[model samples]
Target chain A: MRVLGVDPGLTRLGLGVVDSGSPTRPQLVAVGVVRTPADESVDVRLGRIAEAFDQWIDEHRPDVVAIERVFARSDVSTIIGTAQASGLTMGLAARRGLPVAMHTPSEVKAAITGSGRADKRQMTHMVTRILRLDAPPKPADAADALGLAITHLWRGAVAGASTPGKEKDVLARRARTTAGTGLTPAQQQWARAMRAARA
Target chain B: MRVLGVDPGLTRLGLGVVDSGSPTRPQLVAVGVVRTPADESVDVRLGRIAEAFDQWIDEHRPDVVAIERVFARSDVSTIIGTAQASGLTMGLAARRGLPVAMHTPSEVKAAITGSGRADKRQMTHMVTRILRLDAPPKPADAADALGLAITHLWRGAVAGASTPGKEKDVLARRARTTAGTGLTPAQQQWARAMRAARA
Candidate 1:
């Protein structure tokens, strides 16, 4: 399956696509950043983002759309803009009938570098190794976008694995993590990612 | 001029329209809320909001779009959702080539009521009176939506009025409010509303 990951932001939105046909060796398909002028009105900037993202979706035609979720508790100045940008991505993906997956920054970091506390350099290094690329994707955000796609792909593999023992282990781990009823599929997949990281 | 005001939210979005052809006697054209099931995914919910808001823009064809700005510092739990929903409104308005106006909650309250610290009841009362409605718009969000439109109308009037003395007074007040250069028109209009309220 092909997955498109977006690290959402107002001034600079990072987008990366990965073809995950081989779960063990995901390949990078595209990576770039979409930037809007800081001087533009919020309305115009958002509209431009939606337009550019729509074009990305049309061109990539990925099976799933993944985004790094924005946390309201983090960076009060940037959270709102990040959330707004992510909303456009989510809405666009839904309109296209594509499944939307969201991973927290920590989750993506953990999945990529085996440590939720990994720094940017570590994540970029790991992504370069995993994708077998000559160099890390430019701008930390672009690497983060690729990391989100790889995270989603691995979690999805864990979720849909036919190995009964591994599936049972994942379910047990997810049961402990969920702690509440009615978790979304993406949330459940995050739990699976957490479990796989621990294993 | 016709203005459509949107009080954006994830579960309940309030929408109101007013025809301000006569600066002194604004008339209500439409008022209601758009609701999405809380159980739905964020992507689905945002998509639904965009679709419904597009229909609203097509149906109303307002000269301007007004929305209450979401602050990242306020109510961390709901701030992200509010920002995301408001983003859709702004993006839609921009795509249709309509000017988008944003008023802070305090600014909206001050414009509708005499005080920036006015309570919800005061706002509802003033909205009912301003729109000459027999009763207050049901739900506080609906009243707030109308308040946004009314605020925009009054501010737009203040910004465009040829009264030299009043324009000079507004410009002086706006100079005080704007700490730096490059304020958006909406920001300048907000300053004008603050000046008019004081007057």
Candidate 2:
């Protein structure tokens, strides 16, 4: 399955496409960034981002879209822009009948590097190794986009599979590393319940 | 000039349409709310809002669109949703090549009641008086939406006018009541500069 991952931002949005041949292996299809001038009006910047998203989706035609979930706890100033950018991505994907999955920073880290608290350097290194790229993707955001795609492939596919035991193992591993997941109380409870059910 | 005001929100988006026959006079064309259930996914909610905005713009054929300027200082949980909704509104307006104006809560209050710090009751009263309506509009969001349209009509038009002196006088009057106008530092400076130039 091919997945397109988006790291949403107002000034610079990162996009990556990955084709998963197996649950353990995924190949990079493409990676790039769409930048909008900070001087531009919000609407104009959003229009540019929307156009970029349309072009990427049309060209890549990924089976699913994965995006970094916007959280309120982060830098308050950029939250609104991040959310708006993420929203545009999701809306565009939905318009095309594409299933979209949102992965938090921690979730992406854990899925890619086996630690929710993994730093950017670790994430970049792991993404390079996972994709078997000769060099790491530039501009941390692009690497993050790929990480989101990888996370979705690992978690989403496992969850959808008929193998409940394997799903439980993945969920348990995720739960153990949920320390920095930035999940809401309700979400944490839901995760705990799922783990318990699988147990 | 006809203006469509959008009070952007995820759950209850308010919309108001007004026609300005004169700078100080605006007639209410219509007012309504678009409700999205909390149970729906974010993409679905945004899609519904996009459709509603499209229909409103198509039907009203407004000369301009006015929307509330989103602030990061608001409730953190809702800020993302609010920004997304606002982005959708702006995107749609931009796509149609319609001029869009963003008015802060203070600006809306000031335009409607001549007091930036006006309470909800005062805003409703002024809106009722200004529109010559028998009763105040239901739902505070709808009234605020109308207030936004009125604000844009009064401020945006004057700013773009060829008469600098008249614009300065109007802006000075607004500045006098700037306590609730929520003008950013840059905006305040721009207003001051305009007043000085006219002087």
Candidate 3:
């Protein structure tokens, strides 16, 4: 199935598309970013985002939409904006009847670079190699959205290869490096809501 | 000088404008949000963001633009996207000869709520009281952008309040919180950076 990964930001929203026709690997189809003006108001900025996202949805029509979920711990403003951004992505996917999945920052790193603490440069460098791109994706944020797509594609393929009796839970693909490591209790509650939305 | 504060995100970019004539309290002249569709391609998203931002700038000539700075220590994709988002805001501000200032999540919290660990509800509540608004700003994220503007005004006021023989370093605020403890070298380095950013 075709997949679209998104790195959401109000000022710059990144998009990457991967055509997963083959079970083992997906081909990069397109990647780009959306920008919002620093001068506009919150409502106007949100409107701009909606319009840009709609155009992409109409063009790609992907089966699955992957979004980078923000596990916000502090900064009420940051978390609220991130949550709104995530909400916008999910709302659009739901409107189109497409399946949506979210990957945490840690899960994304482990999938792309084989470690959760991999830096941005490392993730981009690895993405370029794995996808065999001509150059690293520009505005690294867009590249990251693409990376999320790649991670989901690869994990999905790995799942396809596993035996039915021995398949692992999709979320368990990464190992936590720190003790007491897990989504915060509140975030876990959000995860349940997201899962239900996907179902 | 007129200042614009932006709370960036994918689907909604919140923008708030305040002309802090006295730097102690800014007058709120404008506020709004920009929205985007989920399906747009990367390029289209960028276009919309630029177009929207440009339109807003043309309408309101802000002398300075303050944005919530992205933390680079987190996930690479997020860091990259945040960096890109910061670039867009900075670039837009530059186009209009407006100096740009970036504040971290913690600084904004401490400036507004008197605590860096304050949650969204608390910040919103505080911003409302500070702005003397009839109600909390809608969509929560928008309220935050406004709060950032309020913070800049208050911070500037404090800076302006010093006389020839007087000074008000952020150390006083720090001492309020760190009254009994000594910080490590690394923490001291961070404190300097945080102060320089005026966050």
Candidate 4:
């Protein structure tokens, strides 16, 4: 399947296309980036994002869309950026409610580089090596987009596996056995590992 | 050096202390959990965290504090949980004026396993293997606490001898770079690693 991977940003966005029949590795189809003027109003910038998404869809005709889910942010500006990035991604695949999968940054890094804590250079280098690109993807945007594509394939490799939560169920049972341990079984995190296994 | 590792949670807070020089992995001098009833007010829970922290410090007297830093939370409840957790951790550490170091969850995971995306089971399993424990630490809260401890030792072993900036820095850089392509060299995340090697 052809997967469209996106890395959203305020001033620039990265886009990439990859073919994922090969589980161990995938082929990079196209890698490019989009730049938006940050000084514009929110509405205008969003319009640009929408327009960019439309263009990408028209060009890639991806069978799947994979996005990097945004998480905790304190600053309003950053939160806005994160939402924009995440929203733009969702918007692109919104039509027909495509089966979009969002992976955490750690999940993506781990899938791509064998380490959740892999650095950008590591990720960039891995994306280069994995796709067998002649050179590193330009700007960091292209590399990240490519990483998203790689992450999608890794996720697809084992999508419905048991997760960390199953282990939580086990811990819950243990807590019940140890009653008055002041620990509730459901509250036990070990059992939760089953869900992580799924992730 | 003794490093105290903490895995913060709003409901159940975990703390661990390990000595850095004992072996390849630090010895777990002490570990325990503090509980806060959801029925209690936030301040009371925080007070509970404080009391637990005081008890641990008095008993363990760890030389350094290593905490898992909070990340972007999308849910209000989760964000609140994270904020409470952060406040409790910082408040407890600050009261003693202990040197505190924050590592993102991924960093801790990476430091423990080669992969940052390793779940709690993987983490717990690895922790048992790395610490050479006779039995796996029961209750993931405790297991996570142990994992954080090992991560500190691993990073400390390679501390300043290699790259800098925790995984978050790289993720954020990737976020910006992945979204947009106009990353300035100064804003580039890998520049630090590349420059350090050059020097």
Candidate 5:
């Protein structure tokens, strides 16, 4: 299954695509960041983001799209921008009849690093190891997007038979319950890598 | 000049159109509300809004779009939805090379009535008189949208030579400064009708 993960923002949006043959092995297909000028009007910025989504979706043709959900508690100024951007992405995906899923930051971190409070550095390291990339993706947002995509694949694949909306609830519930569970088999591999680096 | 005003909301979006021959005289062209099911997914709701915007803009061929600016302090659950809907409306207008303006709720109220603190009943009464309609527009949202369009035409025409973005700021500043001042010439006509009603 192929998935496109989006880290929605007004000024800097991160997009990552991954193809998963097995739940444990996901390969990176593409990764990039779309940046809009901070000085531009909100509508213009949103227009640019919409154009970028159109270009990416047309080129990548992912089976499903996964986006990081915006929480109201996060930076009030940015929350609205992020929500608008996500709305555009999801709308475009829905227009194409592709299923879209939303993952919280904590769920993405826990899915990737075995801890819900994993920091950016830890997420980058795990994403790198998961995709077997020689180097971590540039711009923390890009790596974070990859983590979102991987999380959806790992969790959604398990509940793939359910409807998209129901799958989201199931994944969210699982994320809450599995918060501190030592890592998935794929994350366990990364844990071994961390131990090896320490040695 | 032709203007389309949008009162952005997720479940019930309000839209109105008007043609301004003179700054003091504007004629209503169309008005309605677009309702989306509350149970629908965010993306689906956004798509419906986009479709509605397309239809309105295409039919009315508005020279510009005036949308209600969203404030973060509003109901937390609805704020993001309104923002997203407004973003879609603005994005669509921008795509068509049509200018878009945002008016605050207080600006709309003050423009329609002589006071920014005017209640909905006052707004509906003023809108009914201004539009020369047999009855007030159904669903307060629709009346509110017509008020938005009228506000833009009256205020924007005064600063019509300026750029769209700059005109919005200019109108907002003017609205702030002119609040509770004697009514505009068009508003004076409404005042007479109001006085006649009281008598």
Candidate 6:
């Protein structure tokens, strides 16, 4: 499956594309950031982002679009812009009949680095290693977008058999349970793999 | 100037169109609500809203779009959805080269009922009287949408010469000043009119 991951923001939107390779590795297709001038009106900025996103989808032709789930509590000032970008991203993908999967920040971290508490540096390091790239994707948003695509590629693949809406529902329930325990399914999977290797 | 007002919401979006009739009495061109099912995903809902808004603009051919400004502090549970919808509204309007204006909730209330704290009933009542409608617009959203159009028709008319971005900046500054003093420009205008009538 070809997946496009987006880290939605008003001023700078990070995009990463990946093609499913082996069970544990995904091939990097492209990674970049789209920036909208902060001086413009919010609507104009959103329109520009929409235009860029439309172009990206058309060029990449990804089967699925993965986005980072925005939480209102993250930053009151930037939350609205983030949410708007995320909404636009999802809308554009859905309009094209592409399935969209949203992953929490922690989920992406856990999926890429084996720990939900992994910081940006750790996430960048792991994403680079997993994709077998010589260097890490630059500007944290780009790396983060790659992480989102990787997360959906690994975490969402099993649940991907069902309808998109139902798949999200299942993932959401699992996310809630994982949040309650301060662990993600990815983290658990990593732990099991580590134990098996040790044994 | 013809204005299309939008009360942005994920579930039920209210839209109102008005034409510049007389300075004091604008004519209501149309009023209605567009609904997206709650069961649908957020992206699908946004897509439906975009489609409806596009059609509305094509049919009404409004020179400007007036939308309610979404504040993140209001109702955390719904704020994200509201912001997304508002963003999409602005984007759609901006894409079609139609100027977009946003009014605070208090500003709309003051413009319609001469009180920033006017209740829904008073807003509905005044909108009915101003538009000379036989009945209040069906849902509260519809009434609120009309109020937005009327506010822009009156409040925005004077400052309409400037570019839409600059006009919004000026209006935003004024909104901040008005909020601090607990009165909108509309409320002050209403007070002056009352004094003139008494004199």
Q: Which candidate is the best by DockQ?
A: 1
Better of 1 and 3 by lDDT: 1
True contacts kept of 1: 0.71
TM-score to true structure, per model: 0.82, 0.79, 0.43, 0.41, 0.81, 0.82
TM-score of 5: 0.81
lDDT of 6 by residue, A1-199 (tens): 8999999999899999999886555789999998998898888888888888888998999999999988878898899899888887887687778888889999888777878999989888888888888888776569999889988877765444544676566665786676764334654554454333223
In Å, candidate 5's interface RMSD is: 1.6
Q: Give the TM-score of candidate 2.
A: 0.79
Superposed model 4: Cα runs more than 4 Å off? A1-199, B74-76, B161-199
Instruction: Look at candidate 2 and give me any clashing residue pairs.
Output: none
Residue by residue across B1-199, what tens digits does model 1's lDDT show? 8999999999999999999855556789998898999999998998898888888889999999999988877887888888889887787688778989889989888788878999988989888887778988876568888889988888776555444767566665676577553334444665554454334
Residue-level lDDT tens digits of model 4 in A70-89 = 55544544554544445445
Model 5 misplaced regions, further than 4 Å: A162-199, B160-199
Clashing pairs in 1: none
Candidate 6 stretches greater than 4 Å from native: A160-199, B160-199
Q: Which ten residues in a row have the lowest lDDT in candidate 2 chain B?
A: B190-199
Model 4 chain B lDDT-worst window of ten: B190-199
Native RMSD of candidate 2 (Å): 8.7
- Better structure of 4 and 5 per DockQ: 5
Candidate 5 residue-wise lDDT, A56-168, digit = tens: 99999999899998776778878778877877777677777888888999999987888899999998998988888899887667998888998888776544444466655
Model 6 chain B: lowest-lDDT 10 consecutive positions: B190-199
Tens-place lDDT per residue, model 6, B1-199, is 8999999888889999989786656788999999999998888888888888888999999999999998878898888888888887887687778888889999989777878999988888988878878887776669999989988877765453444666556665786686764334544454454333223
Query: lDDT (0-100) at residue A5 of candidate 6?
Result: 95
Which regions of candidate 3 deviate over 4 angstroms? A74-77, A160-199, B1-199
Tell me the docking grade of candidate 6. acceptable
Candidate number with the higher TM-score (1 or 5): 1
